[model samples]
Target: MSSFEPKIVTFLCNWCSYGAADLAGVSRFQYPPNMRVIRVPCSGRISPKMILAALRKGADGVWISGCHPGDCHYIEGNYYARRKFTLLKEMLEFNGIEPGRLHFSWISSAEGVKFAEVANKVIDEVRQLGPAKVFIKESPEESAA
Candidate 1:
């Protein structure tokens, strides 16, 4: 039988990580297509509720990507995202969520190669950890049904 394809949700900053991902595609850098990319104006826009929503929607892994330090178009958006992700990591752990289910990284618009590398690496890590089933929340409709 074939291996399972883990569903990954990636939040990419429009100014950086999203461009890098676009570059990766233009450069023909091959990577798995298991990820659903969500383009945000800044990584800082990724709220905890959005992250939880992805998991609740059946995503097996989540990735948050932003500009490299000091390269954010919004000046300090990435810094805030970094800090928020750090706190989110701790909160997830406190709730018994596996740390491996979430990842954060910096990718610049010029780093097409880096984007592919990070994509493959994250995929590998999630694969090794298997599908994330813990901490999944039931939707209100599902609960009612």
Candidate 2:
């Protein structure tokens, strides 16, 4: 019932999380209508810059869901994602962004109910943290003092 519905950018792996999301929709499993999904070939393909860009683009939070480490379609994609996720957490914290604003999970294509549950959880966590303060750059002239 809160008006502060956080806008979340969600990255899903094509072979796993993406399918789960689709299933969730088809099954009518409901979660908060806060996330905008971007399905990628694999979670390993998601770069830190991409995540940072989403935050810069005004997303209140980000959620990345991929195949379980051993179940990755691309063999080791999710493993790499986990590594990148750790680095990204440190970077976000250094940049003054709360680590809670970002979330990650491993989801197989069949777990539609789990997908919905995680979605709701992510939205709730972000909502509790309030809106993210996006990074803004000053104009060249403004910085020329």
Candidate 3:
């Protein structure tokens, strides 16, 4: 109920998490409405720049969801995503971004309940972290020495 409803940007695989999220909606599974989901062909399509872009665009947190490592629609797409996200996580932390501000999960197309659960969990964690002020861009004057 806080004024800071953290903006969560979720990149979901079209064949899995995206379908699962649609199922969650149809099931009327209650979840935080703060997530702005972007459906992609595969999680492998997600890039570090994409995640950082979402944060720069006002996302308080970011998530990338896909099929299980061995279940990616594009053979090993999820595996690739996993590796990329792992390295990106470390880079974000080293760059002054909070480590907890980004996350990743795997959800099958049939797991409507899981989609709702993950969505709620991500929102809760972000809420505890408060607003993503650090992710916000500073104006020219603010960044000026």
Candidate 4:
């Protein structure tokens, strides 16, 4: 069998986490290439449906990152995001999704090192969890076959 490499779907807030990721790239910080980033205007813009969709589409792991608490560009956006993430996490776990398959963090634009570190940590955790099998939405033909 071929080696397994988990596919991580990362939702990053444009004002902070995305900038930190960009900084990490520009600074040449080493990190795994397992993440597929989706930049959002703010963390609060990420809905539960978006995360669930990623999982259903076969993401082995999902990560959502934003500015530090009280540091959102939209003032209270991160606060809202934090609440949403907590509830979403609980709901997913209740429905049998592995806890290690989802993650959340706060990373500022100046924290490129932290960004890289978190990226490694997330990748390692997902690798330990192995490939995602739950909640994947196979095509109708595949399902029929």
Candidate 5:
């Protein structure tokens, strides 16, 4: 439907992407209000289960942003995230989920504009796909009501 607005779950690295997001807000950059952000110490700390959990919990899309290559405060954390993300993408495909519903980016703390741009891009791509069908799990609270 033309009125569809997808819900996105976002994971951002504390030292980089999160800072960029904060800066984006401070700079008055306007982007779609579709994301629910979860800040982590490093993108490398994000487990595949967490992404899957987000999907299962009714997130229409998921985005992960981290430090640029060679700039992880934790040293090599972003590299680890990059490698894990590659494998995770394949896994999502194997499970019948469109990998396009998932997005990833490398962003520096100083890149506020870039953060807004990527946020808009991710939202547009997910909106085009409409709502996700698979991987949605009803929680106990939902079942109770």
Candidate 6:
């Protein structure tokens, strides 16, 4: 097959990671255009269902980025996010999702360079995994046929 370009679903905490992504853009840092970002009020708001939905919708990978521990604008939000991410990641892996298909990170608005770096890393890893197979939802017509 031709070279694969994986589709990525990215969840960014509005106060931190989202700002960092915007900063990376303004700084002209280059990264792959493979990600579709969803901005959330805080990382703590992310649910396992959301991640699964992305995968089911045919995303090859998913990434969640939020404020560093102890630095959440919502005060303790990232703490909750950390625990949820840990457990959800493990569960997804146990359920047959490849370990490399999910990623998590902490990035502040001033860390534009770091944001670019992480973006590149995430894209590279997912590309290596090729197209997603499991849990992908077929279109209605395709399924009906």
Per-candidate clashes, comma-separated: 0, 0, 0, 0, 0, 0
Screening candidate 1 with a backbone cut-off below 3 angstroms (N, C-alpha, C), the clashing residue pairs are: none
Q: Report the error of model 5 at residue 97, Å.
A: 0.8
lDDT of 3 at 24: 99
Q: Estimate each model's TM-score.
A: 0.91, 0.91, 0.90, 0.91, 0.92, 0.91
Candidate 5 regions off by >4 Å?
Answer: 136-145
Candidate 6 lDDT over 1-145, as tens digits, reads 2588899999999999999999999999999999999999999999877887789888999999999988999999888988998998898788888889999999998899999999999999989888887664556755676
> Which regions in candidate 3 have their CA more than 4 angstroms from the true location?
135-145
Residues 1-145, model 2: lDDT tens digits:
3678999999999999999999999999999888999989999999887787788779999999999879998889899999999998998899889999999999999999999999999999999989888784544654584
Off by over 4 Å in 6: 136-145
Candidate topping TM-score: 5
Clashing pairs in 6: none
For candidate 1, the 10 contiguous residues with the lowest summed lDDT are 134-143
Q: Residue 24 deviation, candidate 1, in Å?
A: 0.5
Q: Give the winner by lDDT.
A: 5
lDDT scores of the candidates, listed in order: 0.90, 0.91, 0.89, 0.91, 0.92, 0.90
Q: How far out, in Å, is residue 79 in model 4? A: 0.8
Candidate 3 Cα RMSD after full superposition onto the native fold (Å): 4.3
Scored against the true structure, residue 62 in model 2 reaches a CA lDDT of 94
How far does residue 80 in candidate 4 sit from its true spot (Å)? 0.7
Residue range 95-130, candidate 5, lDDT tens digits = 889989989999999999999999999999999999
10 residues in a row with least lDDT, candidate 5: 134-143
Worst 10 residues of 2 by lDDT: 136-145
Greater TM-score among 1 and 5 belongs to 5
